[model samples]
Target: MPPGVPLSPPPPSALANPESLTRRSHRFQPKSIWPVAILAMFVMLAIVGIKAYRSLSQNPAQSEQTVEQEARLPVRVTRAETGLAQKWVFDDGIVWPVKRRVLTFQAEGDIQAIAKINGRDLRAGDVVTKGQVLATIDSRRQRSAIDTANADVEVAVQQRNQAQATVVQAQASLDRAKSDLELAKTELVRYQELFDQGVISESDRDVYLNQVDQAEAALRSAEQDVRSAEDGVRSAEAQITAAQARVTETNVDLEDTQLVAPIDGVVAYINIREGEYWDAQRLNSGSDQDLIESAPIILVNPQDIEVEIEIQADEANEIDPGQLTYVVLEEDVSAAQAAGASNQDLLEIAQDNGSRGTVFSVSPTQTPGSRGTQVSIRGFSSAQNLR
Candidate 1:
């Protein structure tokens, strides 16, 4: 405590204890502490951190609830019940004519005339009666053959008449021979009776017996000639019959020279031209000389049109002959939209509008690439009118 003497430094043990050293040491130590301000700042920071954590934990649940409410908004829906003969799935298919026929020549010949050609518009669905002529071949050779057959028949008929005359002559000769034989037998008996009664000489009786033998021999010869002549007549008659049969067959072939349509149809193709040679059996040699090849001279389709569709065996059982059906044409977006005021309402407005079609047939076999069934749709209106 002397002012002039420097305050003796505090003891090491007392300096080590900060509270005691700060109070006792002569060097000034600040009494106002800053630890309370630092503690207060730490407390404020902890409170703010707790509040922020609580807000962050609740934000995600509130956002998810808002999203769920938006997702529950209502949408429009429609339902319809339609009668269908058969439900069918679409498949890739080819269009084909309903009926087809080919006209061919009966005999090999050159085409003399062609009444029609390809691409010509023919009357649709006209019925062709039996024996109608559709096309013609060269008739010169066919007529010549027919004439030859006719000449042969005429010759055969003349020969048959001559044979008939021979048969009549043979029959007459047989009758005469039989009468002569009987007369000879009666003469022989009379001569024997006369010789036994001694009314005739021995030489005369022997001569009469010889004469009877000669007459009998003559009658046998005549009968044999008659039999030969009858046989010849029969042979000639058979030849005549065969010749007549040949004439009839030739006539039939001649009639077949002209090709005719077999059924009612529309002409589709005409392959022959006038003066064209048609040989069905001839083959091409690949040489420079061109030979006419014969195929179907004309092609036709029948009046009745039919569509064929392939379907699964299981689905075909539901189809009937007279059930009602509907067909939807190719999608027309413009037409669909025009029927309604808005795009969202188009389907409902078009339910009773647009072109109508129908189902025509169903096939028994499964179509290629189809898992279920296939059906054929046909337009009720004419093909030209259908879109």
Candidate 2:
């Protein structure tokens, strides 16, 4: 009976608020949320599975890569082969050539000419051969003197020839005089025999005797002429000899005007140039060192370059002729100075600078007043940094 009365109509409030009814309906059916939760759970599981699969897929390669990287250590490698083992000795030294010469003019004059190379005037560092005429002073005066001497010699020679002709003429006259004297004597003797036999008169015999006397006088005169001619010839010969000597002297003077190189070498220094005056007496007046320093030309054999070093006796003992050597450069010297250099450092410096050489000579004994010895290193001049 009550349900039949309630069934009159649904309430307006309940009808107006449909959301409440829906909420009420949802409250009674809680099982509906499980499908969405299950879907979300499945989505999360898929994400987890994808991540796990990716991690599993990359781990083996990464692990292998890491293992490979960790297995190796950084190192350098080189081929094993036989080679020369070098021992280095460190030192500071002075470099010079073994064969050096200082050349100067022997006569005083203005320089008229100088050697040339590559179309340029000869300068320091130019190579030259033995007997090269490096320069020549003005030789006009010497040439003039030589010309005068030659003229004198020619004149003297002519005099000698004239004197020789005169001697020949005198000899011919002497021969004729001898024949005349012999004829006169024979005639005189024949005339005397005739007179003794009373076949000739006294006057004829007397005339023949007189002829003989005259002939003797002529012979004496001819002999004197011959002697005078010989004397004149001798005088002419002496004058010729003296004139020739003068010619020789002038030739030597002319030669003195030129500067010649005595050996094959490079020009180390040149003080004279064309048109400059050179004075032998003045240039040669200074001490040897000064002379060398101021000499007109200086030459050095590049292949015979040498370096002189003063090192401790103990250090020098390790060096000998034919041992390898090297030169420390200025830059290397600075670095060495900063680091208190060792032999190894010096070796590295020399190798980098390319100044390689060999020991040429070592003093046999220590220096007189110190425990040091002198050592010489030989190298080519092309080793630019060797000094």
Candidate 3:
């Protein structure tokens, strides 16, 4: 064939199949096939988008719920040796110190400075021993008072010495007057004897008698002076005693300036500070009219602490003294703090920190207006920080 001539149509064997014809026609019309492909793609994308939207909206809530479940505390379980369920009753109670001391000013005065322990100033939450000096008041005036009392005592001693000397002098003077009186009496008796025997005149005898009376009067005056002197000595002694008493009292007041801890305890509170006046009137004695949280200072014994349990009156009767009791705390703790996480397969998370104790005391009678009986248990975990 010439190079310019067109080729003739191919034979029918190759194009005999309708499928092959269809394929060729389809290739020629690519735009028509594109629209169908795009529509199918749109349908598939719509399905996928609906599923994805639903998944995004619902997955967060489910994840949040799963996290909450993980953080939730597990319940505590108590078992009996018999593997049988035991009925246990719960109650509300308070844990407190066994014996707490309400520290107060034994003597009223202005606060000076809190006593330092190992150079650390004493304050609330400080541990103290018995008879430890906790604080000091303004004792300058008290020292002055003690000095004045001492001076008073010295003056009294001097006065007493003077009184004793006066008594001795008075006694000496009385002795001399007595000697003169005896002499006068002897002379008067001799004169009377002479008058009776006619040895002397009557006038002479009468003069001698008058001399005896004068001597007796002088003796009486001396005796009275001695009595007065003795009385003065007694008065001086009394003054000395009174002065000594004052001195003792002043010394006591001076000691009062130092606040001492009466027992071994931790200082729970301090309602006063240095240089501040502690008003004793705020202290609560035996009276229903007023109640105080604490005294100017307070002490709590950390070694001894107890929990008071309250339960229904009927239930209290069911529990005997020395019977074991388990107290469940109202609060919860994290799983990390739990005692044994393995045995707690029944429940997960917050296991009970229940304290083990025994019933030691039963109330003699129900408290007035109380809904239950009060019982005391001695052994439990002591919580020092009440606040």
Candidate 4:
């Protein structure tokens, strides 16, 4: 055993079995498979044994019933009740006032005042009563016109009185002319009788003839004067009639200056402000296509809020007065639809978020210029917020 001696060769037995020389690697052995298979068989046998024991412990009929009960599914049931058939219909529509009016002035002037509510100037959505003054224009011009017309009427009356007096004077003159003519005729007869009796000269009878001619001329002149006076009276009467017409016109203009609410309603719109100039011409002759929308004031009776829905003629026929209706807002409908809500859900949403209404009217005929029929539904209660 020296340190420099050569290493010796491996043993033939170790070389023949290299696996035995290193640590042995674990591998599936045929011997282990039988134990796993036996364990699984024992587990199956235990489950079957348990089932057989439980089955034998109960009566045969009771066991069958238990199995059947366990195999069957559960269900719910309710007692029968009587009820009427019901159906639901959904539609979109706009809520409008049953009575709507657009008010404008016939006379143009500067707006002097606007109606107030709760100490604030009148505006859209304000409530008003019938004949309430919604606004007023400067009425001085119309008032002046009325005064002028009245003055003209008074002047015409004066002229008429003066003419009547002239007529009376003319009548007096006519009467006097008649009396003079009679007197002249009587004198001529007397002169003729005297001349025939040779108690009057021919020259004197000729002088009586000249006096009768002069009296006739005076009567003709008086008749002409009476006719002239009567004409003056007729002219004065015509003037009076014309002046009265003017007065009536001015009164109408004055009324036009004040915008009055024609119905009990809410103010839907106000196109004018205090101190703004009002022009009637725009109402009648403006280029705007809708005169009503352009009016100075717009009113709507929201207490009679009616939802106007256009539907197929067939659908309209199914609707009747007093039928229940629900009006859901467009936003609610959209949201509910986006959430994939069912019809019942939509109805519930409408009940919670929208107004309840009743079918007020259903048009028998199609709407004018449209193929759809109009169905009107009014709120069950007065809805001031509908409009």
List per-prediction Cα lDDT, in the order shown.
0.60, 0.82, 0.73, 0.82
Cα error of candidate 3 at position 355, Å: 4.7
Better of 1 and 3 by lDDT: 3
Can you list the residue pairs that collide in candidate 3? 74-350
Per-residue lDDT tens digits for candidate 4, residues 89-207, read: 55656666778988888888889999889999998878899989888999998999999999999999999999999999999999999999999999999999999999989999989
lDDT per residue as tens, model 3, 11-109: 577448877766677464323344577799999999999998887778787979977998797778898563423235657676656777666665767
How does candidate 1 fare on TM-score? 0.54
At residue 175, what lDDT does model 4 achieve? 96
Q: What is the lDDT of residue 32 in candidate 3?
A: 34
By TM-score: ranked, best first: 4, 3, 2, 1
lDDT per residue for candidate 1 within 178-238, as digits (tens), equals 7877887788788889999999988877876787787778778777877777777777778
* Model 4 TM-score on a 0 to 1 scale: 0.62
lDDT of 1: 0.60
Residue pairs of candidate 2 with colliding backbone atoms: none
RMSD of 3: 29.1
Q: How close to the true structure is residue 178 of candidate 1, measured as C-alpha lDDT?
A: 78
Backbone clashes in model 4, listed as residue pairs: none
Candidate 2 lDDT over residue span 56-89, tens digit each = 7887879799879987977788988764455544
Q: What is the C-alpha local distance difference test score of candidate 2?
A: 0.82
Weakest 10 consecutive residues of candidate 4 by summed lDDT: 24-33
